[model samples]
Target: MSKHLFSASLLLAISLVVGKSAWGDDNAQSPEPMPPQLEATIKAFEAIGGMHEYRECYGFPSLKFHFFGLKLDSTDADIKKMPVVPFPFAFTSISNSITDLGVAELAKQKNMRALNLVDAQISGQGLAELTHVKDLEVLNLSNSSIQDKGLEALSNFPQLRALRLGNTEVTDDCFVYVSRLKDLEALDLRFTQVQGKKLNELKPCEKLQQLLFSGCPVTDERLQELGKREALEGLDLDYTQVTDNGTKTLENFPNLRNLSLSATKIADQGLEDVGKQKRLQRLYLSGTRVTDEGMSHLGGLDQLEELALSETKVQDAGLAKLSDLKNLNNLKLIRTQVTGTGFDAFSDVPLQTLNLSHAPISDSGMKAIAQIKTLKELTLDHVPLSDEGAKQLASLDNLTLLSLGHSNIGEEGLKSVSQMSKLRVLDLSDTPVSDDSIKELAKLKELRLLYLSGSVITKDSIAQLKKALPNCDIQSDSK
Candidate 1:
């Protein structure tokens, strides 16, 4: 019987025993009677492990006990002889040096569910032992020194759903063996030598939803094949040779929503196909050759919500097209060229994040952004925004994170931003703010992280500021 029902039976037995008076007088009241079935159930529990820990609940239709991490090797043969918590599910760790092959063997024998041999130093030989467990669902072999040989052994597991092979020496050929497991859903091939020839064999599993090919040789062409998978929802192809042609192939994937094409040759023409995919919600084209021309195509995508163009050739003109995408919520133009005209494009859209670092924006650009009352996060690092721009930004009551690092803002400009009570993370680095304005910052009790690097403020000033705001994490490179 379940442990919970067994515990309830034991409690009923104790109440029955306490109610009966062994030597009661003839006139004395009879003790409360107990159920005989409950007493018998207690005897059954005592026959087993003698109840180390047990609980019963009628509110929810489930029973659980804490026999995990308990030593099954006891001196008493009565308890020592029983099966070691058959199908150990919540068991935490098993040392390899102990040679407890019975642990994995028992799981297979009893139809156990989850097995985590992560960082256990298991190799091909150890993995071979697990293939017999056909019911295995989730297996984590991360940092276990599993090579391609070990991965080859996993092909036998027919029910494997999630597998982690991070930080292992497995190569691209490993995907060939991994692909054989048709039931596989989630896989991690991060930081492997899988590229070119190795990547050609990596195809979509029937149920695979999330796949991480970070630091691998997966180009845009491979991602194009992946995009066609009806089940694929998330794909990461960061730092690959895939170009706009590869992305065009992805238009075949009607279900694709999130795609990362960072550090590639994706330009405006590449985005033309991407813009046509109405299902695309988020696209990352950072560190590429995408310019304002690419923005023209992106403007046509109705479902486009988030776009990241960091470290690209995207200027203000490209961003103007985004005004047509009513669902566009976040836009990152960091280290790009977004001027006043581009900032005005967001006036109609409700954006939450706007990163324009290393741009050449003036006060006019800030005024244009001020029209976006939905803006919560704004970055103007290394830009030419002056005190007037700062004043315009201070007017946005929804502003939470503001970075004015290396900008031409003075003490007066910094003071203008002090009224933003909702500000959480502020970077005033390389500005002309002095110790006199530190007191004003203390009023922003919601501030969590504050950066004052390369500013005119002194070390003593930071120390005094810390004293006023003891709980805030202040980072200053002034020394």
Candidate 2:
């Protein structure tokens, strides 16, 4: 059987074992018997390669179940021989191949609290069948054929807490029904026709916290209506028309913690307003006009943890200003002008992960990075590091994952890399290292994964290295 089918069958067997034990105990209080409608629904779902899991609730025999409708090559006759499931599902996901008949069977699951129908063929009329699921709190119909009339079916789910309609045909007219969901907390309308003009319709949802409008035509004027939502915490405006003026309205959301302005017209002036968000934890400014000057504004965001500055003009001087962000741990400077001169500034920042792929890092920069003792993962793909520069990485005693692909590191560098006894994953693809360096790589007794694609190592050398490190998953061009 295929891997998907094998996994589903194993889970079903385990669930049956647990169910038999629970039901066979006369002294144990068993869950209420399954209704006939639910039994038929489970059988119908199983015919379409569906899998269900049951778990005991609060130390009691009463169990709650989750259903998954996976697309597999199993035939209806094969599924008919499987054992029956005797529990109600609280979560159901019917993606890619669900039909109207399948959805009609799903409506009988009154205990469903979350449903995902992404990329399904069901229409608005099919969605109306789910109105009986009063306890449904989360619904995802992204990449579906659901339109404005189909969204009207959501009026029956006033207690819904989250809804995602990305890449759908729904327009601004759908918000008329969406605005009535007063208990809604999160909404995703990415890549849809619903512009921000009608976003004010969501004012009744005072508990709204997260809103994603990425790949939409949201303008600065329409964005202002969201300024009054002080309860808002996360917002994504990637690929929108909003500029620096649009970001000025962000200060009204004092509780905002995560923000993404990638691929937008936001410039250095916008970072000035973004710096005002003292509680901001994650920020993405990739593909923007932010330069070295804008880095000064981010110094006050002491709570910042993750920041992405890829594909921008940020250089060494820009990184020096971020030295005071002690809480910052993850940073990406891919395709930037950084040469590693300011890496010493992060010595006291406790950074654990850093990516500098495609950057012009020099030998001195590699030497400076060696001082960061807390670094556990590092990437330097497409860098012009010399053999001596690659050797400097040996000082990172805690390094577990390292990538030096497409660099000039030779056999001498691989010798130093072998000294990292704690290294778990190593990538030397597209480098100048040859068969002579295979002995050095074999010394990594703890290495679990190794990649040497596009290297000059011969097939004989790879076979010998594989024999030496039998536990390692070595991937070389010769293989």
| Residue 95 lDDT in candidate 1 | 36
lDDT of 1 at 24: 15
Q: What global local distance difference test value does model 2 have?
A: 0.76
Full-model lDDT for every candidate: 0.63, 0.76
- Please give the lDDT score at residue 21 for candidate 2: 14
> Which candidate leads the pack in lDDT?
2
* Candidate 2, position 61, lDDT: 16
**Candidate 1, lDDT over the whole model:** 0.63
Let me know the TM-score candidate 1 reaches against the reference structure: 0.71
Q: List, residue by residue over 1-479, the lDDT tens digit for candidate 2.
A: 11122232233232332212111121223345556666576666566666643332211012222232222232324333433333434443434666555565566666666666777676777778777888777677888778888777887777687788889988877888898899888788889987787877888888877788888899999898775888787788988998999999997789877788988999999999999999898888889999999999999999988899999999999999999999988888999999998997887888888999899999899998899888888888889988889889899989877888887888888878899999877878888888899889999998877888888899999999999999777877674
**Regions of candidate 2 where Cα sits further than 4 Å from its true position:** 1-48, 51-95
Q: Candidate 1 residues 231-333, lDDT tens each?
A: 7655556776777777767655667667777787777788878777777777888898988777888877788777888899877777777789888878877
lDDT of 2 at 245: 95
